[model samples]
Target: MEQYKGRAIVQKIAAGRIWFYTKEEQSVKRYRVEDTEKEWKRYEAARDEAVRELNGLREKAVRELGEINAAIFEAHALMLEDRDYSDSVKNIIETQGVNAEYAVAATGDNFARMFSGMEDEYFRAKAADVQDISERVIGILSGRRKRKKMGKEPVIVVAEDLAPSETVQMDKSKVLGFVTRQGSSQSHTAILARTMNLPALIGVPVREEWDGKMAVLDGVNGLLYVDPDEETLENMRKLQKEEQERIRLLTEYKDQETVTKSGRRVRLCANVGSVSDVAGALQNGAEGIGLFRSEYLFLEADHCPTEEEQFQTYRLAVEMMAGKPVVIRTIDIGADKRAPYMEGEPFHLEQETNPAMGLRGIRLSLEKEELFKTQLRAILRAGAYGEVSILYPLITSVEEFKRAKALLKEVEEELADFGIPCGKVRQGVMIETPAAAVLSDLLAAEAEFFSIGTNDLSQYTMAVDRENPRTEEYFDSHHPALLRLIEYTVKNARAAGIPVGICGDLGSDESLTEFFVKVGVDELSVPPSRVLPLREKIRNID
Candidate 1:
């Protein structure tokens, strides 16, 4: 085998192995397998092993990556534990009773034929994962595939599109990068790649059977090649080394305050949804939890959380911050995030072609007073434990703000009457809707603070349905019009003597940090991993 270099991205080195991908050509390939009974048993055993291994990974991911990442791991586990696929394979084996190899061969052949006729590329790729899994299982059962001792030399792996199991099964120590023909940004494989921090690229075509061949994977550009010239490889290696060096330098000051060259200082906080993320944020050097999503209290449960449950959760988050501010948004649920317990409320069963624009956020809370009241009571009860503030979502009108504030006041008074210790809770509004942005001055008069939720604000201002692919191009958060809305809201907040911050994808974007600062954003809350990098970027901003 000839040795060639691929653009290498060093993912986390764990368990003495590395995992990555190399780019390869996009061509249909055929694998012939014979149908047999022994093959079916082998497939079953392999499936069992994969399921067990994936479960262990899921548990680890929950502890390390937290609940959102844990959900991703669970999704992969379910895909492997697909009941329909397993049952179909079982029925075929029982009737045919063929040899193991033949059974494996027939299963692949049949599924390949069926999938080849499908229109959706995602479904078509499913056949490849199934075929690969069956082959790996059969090889292990038949004693054809052996565990090879991979050397220390790194290699960029190239493939059409790899299965989750295939990616996870490799000896990660030798894998330098990953390039695939297909993968969405949110695909399981892509998520794994990101979490692992491997420089990788997907959804690009590779050429020819180049396995064990000298190749180069340019992850940043999504390119791969075989037998590249020396100059090309050397340039890529230099770039890679420079990036690592810069990262090392950034690590030294990760936990320090980010101050500009002229000593203009700004606070960096984290936006988190669950308690599990609290430790990670603090460890990553976040000053505090800026936007604590309170929606998790209402999601993934049979019913609304009790006041004490929310209090405990909020208290834990506040205490973890160690005197840092925790701005918790009240339950921001609607048609898209419907809770099982709120099925009888208006818009509970309401269908919308564009749920993003439908009755949601503060509207749901406003229309359903009891539902809103329950969450208000919880936030109030939690306030005595630490410094906490309430953020209301989707406030398009002054009346919604009035009603929500009035209800919160009533809940606090009722709690006081019941001898429950409650303290002052500051209130704010999330300026996400276009209507809300237009009326920022009015809302700022009553709302104590303002937070521009650019995710929804961009969608509303652009009038683009984010979920619809046809309008995806129109969903630009950087559009001049959206920025004007942000400017409008920020200006209003400043004029009203209320603080404003940005807690969205826009905040984490290092390129936009200076722009956000220029716009007079007081605080920038982002994901934990981005805090340091953004701090580094902001420190240089004029």
Candidate 2:
């Protein structure tokens, strides 16, 4: 066997496949192969256990109440209990499975065909899992034992893409870095790798022949060297040492307040979606969580999170932030983020051509008062722990603001009736749509604050779908119309005497910081990395 020694991160564990990246021809390549038999068997046992547990879950879901639909839960059960799936293995075992490995490989192919046409990506990926699981089951049936894929030599995992679940399975000690054939730095795999303090490089090219090789991965500078000469290897080691030192220097500054030389202090807050992300924000020296996208509480849970559950989540975030201002955006669910518990036919069945203007953001929240109320109560109850503010999203009309505020009032009254002292939770609206911007003056009068969601504002103002690659060119945040809308919202907020903040990707943009300052936004909240740079830029601005 040819051995190319280098660095790699373990991205996935399935069907004895160990994928890694190496730069052989001025490009990265994804290599994969069969892991040892023992590792394969261990994973197989785990799968069987999971399958059994999942089946039990399905049965219990029917007998008891679940957050998600019982029917949906049962579908997973049916998949596990599929006759065709189990029978394929049974048939293979009856014939001594030829080679048990070969028989399991055949079963994988069969399951893939059966699930290939399914619409869900999760289920489709499950087919691959089935293949892995079946391979293990067959191995167990045939009594094959082997070792795990951890090697003493360092390796850099390279793949076309790595899922979050796959990324978490990495053996950190053996993984030097990760280089992917296709991925953006903002993707989940990259983010997870960064959080884990591992080197990760994406957007590399790959091929099948790269299997069982070594490659030097430089995630800091996005460089990958495959099968390099002695000189190149030595140089890389030196560069790695320098990079580590630079990171160490940066770490010392992380805990310090992000103050500019000119004495302009901007709140460097983290934008988070989950409670687990609290540590990342604090580690990055976030003054507070500027935008806590609370959708995970609703979306991750099978059913709508109860008022108490929502309260606990907010409480945890508040505790984590140590009373820093946490701008909790109300459940930002929409046609794009459909909830089974919410009112609305299947989103796909009656999708609007103009979903941006359709049932989304605050519009959908109003339709589902129960869902909205549950979130509001949670925020209010949690307010006792720390500074929590409610940010309403996708508000298009003055009436919608009035109605939502009235509901808030109702919630406050209900809390009072129970002798619970609801904390002072300020209310605000996201200036996202064109209508919201145009009517910002009126909405600002009713709302406590304004946060310009530039992503949607740019889309609505420019009349461009950001998702469409063909029209991506027109989807600039710097478009004159978008700038004007931002100017308008900031102006309106100033007039209403309410604090206004920019919370979108544009907020952190150094190029736009000056313009946003000129437009007179009270605050600018960006990602953790941009905090210092943007602060520096603003400090330099006269």
Candidate 3:
């Protein structure tokens, strides 16, 4: 028996034979080209073909996964059209008089290295994206592009690493789980695994000899057992059966109300990143849309989205909810989620040593008044479609909250003056900072409701970087000080006659569900997949 440990992305158990995933390797070699223009034309043709392939993949992804996942391919397509990237490829081909394939390979390497060297984890993970697209174009140029194939029976896939495009193209039904030698939690592969609810592990050394061998993947304990002993195999099978039973039972709570044994009812909502997530949320039996992360609009684009674009997107989500309350948090940009255009134009966000604590969230919104007003107007316009509420993120002081509300009011009047129809939006504040939690009493009196962003609150309170693996031990979410802050915020909200909810990752913690319910938490918003499981926990609570 051999035991290995790796980080788990999805907490599940699977037992299957190992199937080593292998791809046709293409080695690009530099060769002198007689006609530089001809070589550039060949590269352009291959790039266009790659874009077409990506468009097809995007459509397929939308049918299988939701639009949120499909958006990855959209970004890849945009990358193909990027002027800087194309210029680099063209310049390399024309200057060096090299084959198109060699130029493309070099450009991809340079860009991937640049992204890998970034300090931000989010940007660092983009290295894989560059490699994926570059390899895709090269494959097209070399006539070596091929889709991965697996046998009919399910098996655990072992690989060095997986690109987002490759992961999406695989036969999902035949895949029991995945084990990779290299990947990050922020990688698209990890995100896809979590979305598909497949047991996945990264950073495990894989051997070619292990192919066709029986293995057990325990994602919950972050262990992979290859050629395990009989006793260990039996225990794994038993655990797998129990997990299946738990999932089967969770489905029974889909339509049931999220109420405690003592008859306390709490509104269970789903936090969504984009309009595409609304369908998944409803499918998971979410009663409302909570913490609609609106920043994705800015993150996914090269330029800031227009007011109409934002309005149409918000309107679709609101209409899809069919009158269920939709709490759309305004765009929270800056820091790790920066766009090139935001750094340059009307919103000049200078580079910061410590971006997380720097000008971001509500602070950035208030500083860029026109940008903030554009979003406010869209939210108000979308409100006319259904029940919509506005939630502000990273508000640290009463004055910040007041200034935001005042701006919103100005936009409302602007719309009314034009005789444009708009719906009333409930203004709320997210208690993400320690300062915000301490001043929740005063803010609650002015705001309509409160949502505690425990993710940032814990980070700020413990003075730890949640993204840093070195600080993982110190980034305690259940510390008494953090709990006290939450309790205090809830108490103040109650005093102000307003409802308080938790929308951060902590909201999905089963162990803390009881604590939240006992403390008069009015709502708990989490990912769509967590809604039913959380509802079951809430019902079992006394």
Q: Report, for every candidate in turn, its global Cα lDDT versus the true structure.
A: 0.66, 0.64, 0.84
TM-scores of all candidate predictions against the true structure: 0.60, 0.63, 0.71
> For model 2, how does the per-residue alpha-carbon lDDT over 1-542 read when each residue is reduced to its tens digit?
22232222222211112345322121111222233344335434644654665567567756753434344445444554677765664465445424334545567667765654578744543554454445444444444423234577555566666544345435554665566665443344544453345666555565556656555655434456555567766766787677657555566566665555656555566667667667777876677877887875665544345576678778889998997889999977654454332321111114578755677777767876766787888889898888989988888899988998899999999999999967888989989889999999999889898988887777777877643434655566678888888898889898989988888778866788778776677777665554544555666666
State model 3's lDDT.
0.84
- lDDT for model 2, please: 0.64
- Model 2: clashing residue pairs? 7-155, 7-156, 8-155, 8-156, 8-157, 9-157, 20-158, 21-158, 37-146, 38-146
Which model is ahead, 2 or 3, in terms of TM-score?
Answer: 3
What is the Å distance of residue 302 in model 1 from its true position?
4.9
Least well predicted 10-residue stretch by lDDT in candidate 3: 338-347
Per-residue alpha-carbon lDDT of model 1 for 382-407, expressed as tens digits? 77777888989988899988888999
The per-candidate count of clashes, in order, stands at 32, 10, 0
Error of 1 at 300 (Å): 3.8
Q: Could you give candidate 3's per-residue lDDT for residues 265-334 as a string of tens digits?
A: 9999988766767888998899999888788666654345668768878988999999999999998876
